[model samples]
Target: MVNAHQTFVIVGGGLAGAKAAQALRAEGFTGRVILIGDEPAPPYERPALSKKFLLGKEERESLFVHEPAWYARHEVELHLGQSVTELDRAARTLTLSDGTRVHYDKLLLATGAEPHRLDIPGTGLAGVYHLRRLTHAELLRGVLATLGRENGRLLIAGAGWIGLEVAAAAREYGAEVTVVEAAPSPLHQVLGPELGEVFTDLHREHGVLFHFGARLTEITGQDGMVLAALTDDGDEHPAHAVLSAIGAAPRTALAQSAGLAVLPTQRGGGIRTDAALRTSDPGIWACGDVAAAEHPLYGTHLRVEHWANALHSGPAAARSMLGREVVYDRVPYFFSDQYDLGMEYSGHAPPGSYDQVICRGDVARRTFVAFWLKEGRVLAGMNVNVWDVVEDIQRLIRTGRPVDTAALADPGTDLASLAAPAD
Candidate 1:
């Protein structure tokens, strides 16, 4: 019953959109596929923008999800640098920025997210930067090198993943780096105080300065160039450059304008969708950072902004679009690399959600598995410098069985064996 004349229009040219298109063709869908993006370049992975790519260890070409020729070979109509300005749900059409009307039998909104800009003065200064795009990374790579050579200082706002990774890269370049965070510790929101202290100590050992419990209030500049950053605590730090890495907001304007329901800001705002990634409009679907879909495991709508989410959810949404039964219950996952520490975190354990965080192996040596437990049941786990245990950790969380705390923390016990036997 596949309609050869059917057309599927996908908005946003990030990893999710690209993967969805790939999935459609892989699933033998003969329908027309049109992919549109605001960025001029084809769909690329965002993780490298803050890590290897920013450090100059990765090439620009390596960031793309697929080779440029792959799209043409797949017969996907690629439209770059043109944003869909209007979504007419009634007419089943999208009006691009260039005034071209594109009709679609099914619509996919993979419109990712944009970095949160600071409302403070001097954000538009020459040396003030944000790194949410490939072009931004390209610009920052050169700037960090110049600052390193001059022994210049980099004042970074927010100590999240992006800020910390950039600090690591800048230190590798021999640049003086200082981070300003409102939380008491770096990654305080994600890792909590105990584990967040590990990262704080790690960066300090690498010569990165931190000003905790304070945030940037203003950026002072001269001749439209950044000079220094003034913090809320009335402290001023001299800087040749400043990076605003507060966070990102999902791009949901198109969904909202089209009368699609979106989660409230408190619920990590994004277009609301069902377990199958189907939005309020039956003909439209959402995925990746833009889709706050109901997770079957959690029994709640959750929006995850990570590379893995986009990597898997894209294909999952594609299957749903093809009328396949889909329930997105993938465990939340993300990884980070800073200095010599490489860590992968699986499952959700935001602050109060976990009762205690237990560790296996050596914490001081930076080779350990930290598990967040609630009522003796594992909710999330993070392994630093440890490999090949993600499956066990995810399994523990999925089983929802309370584990023996001592056995769970003992390196001698096998994690897979800790889960209860199925009936």
Candidate 2:
């Protein structure tokens, strides 16, 4: 039971931390809520940094999770551009970057993740960049504008979500783009080879070039500015700017330093937590990308780095902190928009875990729902350019019943009817 007078401290001012603060107030916890963030600005939606914001379709102020006045109204202490440098778990206290120590009754670590940087040379060049924060996006936007003015090329060193989305935005800005990936196809790890080819075809049709199975050996620079990238095959790709989007590593230094147990590298490196989002410490919890939490449905620990996970997990963690015997069982969900394609995926299935993928609707037309099945059971499903079937798809996965492949692939079949009957 949480006492109304106690203090709750949330570290990390990203989506997860902001939502947790909102959840505490919404759940009637009249406690002192303090949120500490390293970023100079308040919590903001990061997904827009690559899409709408990068393309100049959305304004800067619109990216904030809540207006500055909301914090004052809610009586939540908002600390921006201040980092929690040390965590003294035994004393239930945290040391801030400014040498101020604050105590808390309960703590939630939602440190999120950091973008991975390439180890190759020339990464420090002026025209090289990585996208993970608002500032990075802002800087890249300016760089893209310059590229557009000069009609220069943008070389992206990865074909994952961030890379592809930025590629789309760069192309929209009139900058020629080329994407290089180590995998045989883009998004092969998540969507598998067949569906991955769909994205390849889409980008190719839009005049975006791809170098599959290619390794970026070096980035060539002159006068501290990026000029080109050299691959393992001795192919030199020219570019006015380079963007590294090879993915991110979870920000777990705070949790680890506080003596919290973290998952091993092989198991997905993140702070280890139970289904309730409780860490090894009884009074501490974790959520969002920083937590590698055990999932009841998948019988494995998953650390999802997506917007939906942060939105749902924060509330789940907050409820658990209030002693609500809650289980954070929401199915892992994520969406990506690239070019004319909008895709929503639900459920969790490791690569190669599914035996088959059933497609409903036309793949060539790029309007369809693809279901991954293991022994006739739906492991995961993705709707591409198809809207309003996510709830039905999630229901089918939760039912855990065998599904008919022919009926699943039939466009005439109603998705709502596919859910298995309650036991």
**Every model's TM-score:** 0.98, 0.98
lDDT by residue for model 2 (1-423), tens: 334579999999999999999999999999899999999999998999999999889988999989989988998898899999999989999999999898999999999999999999888888889999999999999889888888999999899999999988888888899999999999877888878999898888887899988989999989988889999888999998999999899999988888899998787799999999999999999999999999999888899999999998998999999999989889999999998999999998767899998999999999999999999999999999999999999999999999888999999999889884755
Please give the distance, in angstroms, between residue 14's alpha carbon in candidate 2 and its true position after superposition: 0.8
Candidate 1 per-residue lDDT over residues 207-241, each given as its tens digit: 99999999899999999999999998899999999
Report every candidate's CA lDDT.
Answer: 0.93, 0.92
**Maximum-TM-score candidate:** 1
Q: How many backbone clashes can be found in candidate 2?
A: 0
Clashes of each: 0, 0
The collision pairs in model 1 are none
